[model samples]
Target: MKANPISPTIPLDAEGVHHGHLRLPYSRDDSAWGSVMIPICIVRNGSGPTALLTGGNHGDEYEGPLALFDLARSLDARALSGTVIVVPAMNYPAFRVGTRTSPIDKNNMNRSFPGKSDGTVTQKIADYFHRELLPRADIVLDFHSGGKTLDFLPFCAGHLLPDKAQEAKVFAAVRAFGAPWSMQMTEIDAVGMYDTAAEEMGKVFVTTELGGGGTSRAETVRIARRGVDNLLKHAGILRGAPEILPTRWLEMPDGCFCFAEEDGMIETTVDLGEKVEAGSVVARIWPIGRTGSEPHEIKANISGILVARHFPGLVQSGDCASVVATMAD
Candidate 1:
């Protein structure tokens, strides 16, 4: 297949700000649908390694994209070396509608990696990114947050193996993030995931899950901004002293997946990152009726730290209730 046409690059002032767009094509029948492109603002000084910062891959996760917008507006790239390409809304269609997947394709852009040049809208966008943007990046930081119905504690996800030299860099990036929790993810390949593909290509990449559902959290945004600054310093793109974090890195020797035992309204009694012992009551499920029905108590299976919890109050039978990371003793 012929290479997709490169979008025009718009140059900004000497301060190192510019605007451009990425065009992703769908099918010929929907050619009139035109190219789906996102407005990207690039800022940097002389030619150096490029770092790509993108958000809104999952539309409902609002903070990352908004934070990228703030970074673009406030950054003075003239003082720094290397390029910073900021894509505030990667999934523009979903972002505009405050949804997680493209309304047209109903596909999660994050799951559609190395997309086809002439595939569905989501696939095209993914293909555009893989072909056009990713190859130029020396380091990538993909921002995300929990969707509308779920709340997530701030964390970083990256591969963790004993032998990879890049693992140190990944850990450093996560420590600089200063989030209380960091999850070591094993590499997987499917569609639309930037981290797995970046790893395969041997590029330095990390995915930051910053804050909970919806926007409105200043503290979360501030933390993310600080992380970006620290990463820039670490990369030698910026001249500054990076802040050291008091980080506690935990490994999950065994994970106990908590699934709902009955269909009912679920209520969590424990918070994320909380410690619980085996048989401890972590949640309760009860029928929605006003009349009191016996609430079923959900107990922990192992003594460990609760890493993830279902935020929605409603639960169905077999739905994941929580995940507990336990140390092997």
Candidate 2:
């Protein structure tokens, strides 16, 4: 792969607190040679472990960026034994516009990892993180929530990696985050995700899905903030014990367990954290502008708790309606 053109204003290895930007050149009608400046904060002290914290992968998800912004502003270099690299908005273009994909190229940043330097704008950003940012970390936390299209129960999740040893380490951090729920999940699509890139490099990675609807709640934001602090402490970069909390372990074994089948108005019958049974009606969709038509019911394929649901009142044929999670070992 070719070298990325995105350049950071500060050295990632340098000591002390540095606030800067990841500059990516852009050519537009208004400015022929202007660049998009993605904000970054790095706090470095002596050597222990480098924990990379990132948020705003999708523009509409606000909890990650909000929590990370506060974290970056309040974090002090003198309080750390290692390094804390923070990027509050990974997708600057999309973040600015409050959209799921970049406005410049309409590409999803999370699905564009290990990206090509010569690719589209979004891919270039991903390429830089893949080549430049990710290699400098011992652990990675990429925060996420369902954006405009869906909403989720507050939970921090760890993927089931092929390497059990790595998976164990990641799960420890996930559990340490101490969200209400700790989840072991298998991604429906993991092709070029940043999580996949980090995990593939053997880095311990923990991600989250807080409340969503293209917005955030105060409680979920608090959860995100505390989770970050807990993760830092767990990684030994910060000098403190993690807040102990009893986290309910859950798992999403199959992607087909929750999804919508037709375009209509969705009426969810189950709420997040509510226990559901297999074959139970999770949601029902009313046909668009069709009277006397029976509503189509969406059912839960597996028995567990309803952990996620569609956000908008209306639904497309293929939108995911709800995700049920079962107990995990």
Candidate 3:
């Protein structure tokens, strides 16, 4: 049996139409059974800087990948001045299994970046993207969602420190998302994630979390569509007034971590974007099957905007149960 090819290059037009595929190696055993090649679509215009749009790093996150598909179909190359590379699905194995990591390597693709040439499955794919795709591009827009287990409130996250100029560009691209809220993120190194890698490489990149709780929501699609349009408009690739929503972009202040004190069933008393007072109870966690049992109240650690709440009612100890964006004094 012939081994499968990896990094298959698919040619696309400005309208995002797929014309053909270019195969790239995924592993040493390219001719081995069940080996697979990742696919990328190149839409070249030769006028503007390359804008690379990627999705499906986390396979369970569907909206971003789907939105990229839509973008490839609708975008007009004649109007675009630069190259537009669309990797609709980055984690082929994860996507095949409908999970967050490569089933074969048991690795998260997002965490593995600037990968090695002679590395494992996930690392090799990351290496290919970094070497072949990233260097040629001036900007990158990485689409994402809450993953399989959580439904995130629509938002954007990127490094906010001024010294990281390319990171700042990533944030600006995210701001083009027009999400109701944009968060200046820190502690991203806590996990070796993709956006962090993008920052390290000095590439302008942004990751959008629209919605996810095992399925794609229409609202999520709508928000993602508007986000793509706005980003294109901001990049000067598209000529139109993309709708921008009233936004509340914030910075997470000191003592901002929301560590869960104990594990239990969470009951949120407020929604996303609500204001809360310091030491106020935002949610209560009850013991399993003890509805009337005395519940432990989860209080705000600092006074600020309630930017994100855990969508799943159940949580484990030390998990991020909530987030409060502290207001400036």
For all candidates in order, the CA lDDT equals 0.73, 0.92, 0.71
Judge candidate 3 against the unseen true structure and give its global Cα lDDT, from 0 to 1: 0.71
Give me the displacement of residue 202 in model 3, in angstroms: 2.1
For each candidate, give its TM-score against the true structure.
0.86, 0.98, 0.84
Candidate that beats the other on lDDT, 1 or 3, i.e. the better one = 1
Higher lDDT: candidate 1 or 2?
2
Over 1-329, each residue of candidate 3 has an lDDT whose tens digit, in order, gives 22322445454434433534435544345555444655566766667777778888988888877888787777776766667787778887787778888887898898887666677778777777776677776777887877765555677666664456665677777777787767676653535566666666677777777776656888878777788778877777666666767766777787565666778888888676678888898787778865677988888888887766666778777767677785422
Q: Worst ten-residue run, lDDT, model 2?
A: 253-262
Clashes of each: 7, 0, 14
Return the TM-score for candidate 2, rounded to 2 decimals.
0.98
What digit string (tens of lDDT, one per residue) describes model 1 on residues 1-329? 85655363565323477777765544356576576667788887887778888889988887777778888888777667888888988888798888889987898898888877766777777777787778878888888776765565666666674447888778777666666566665423344476766766777887766666556378767767777777777776766767877655555444476778898898988897788888998889998767768898889888888766766778888876866764323
Ranked by TM-score, top first: 2, 1, 3
Give the winner by TM-score: 1 or 2. Answer: 2
Error of 1 at 133 (Å): 1.3
Best by TM-score: 2
> What residue runs in model 2 are displaced by over 4 Å at the alpha carbon?
none
Of 2 and 3, the candidate ahead on lDDT is 2
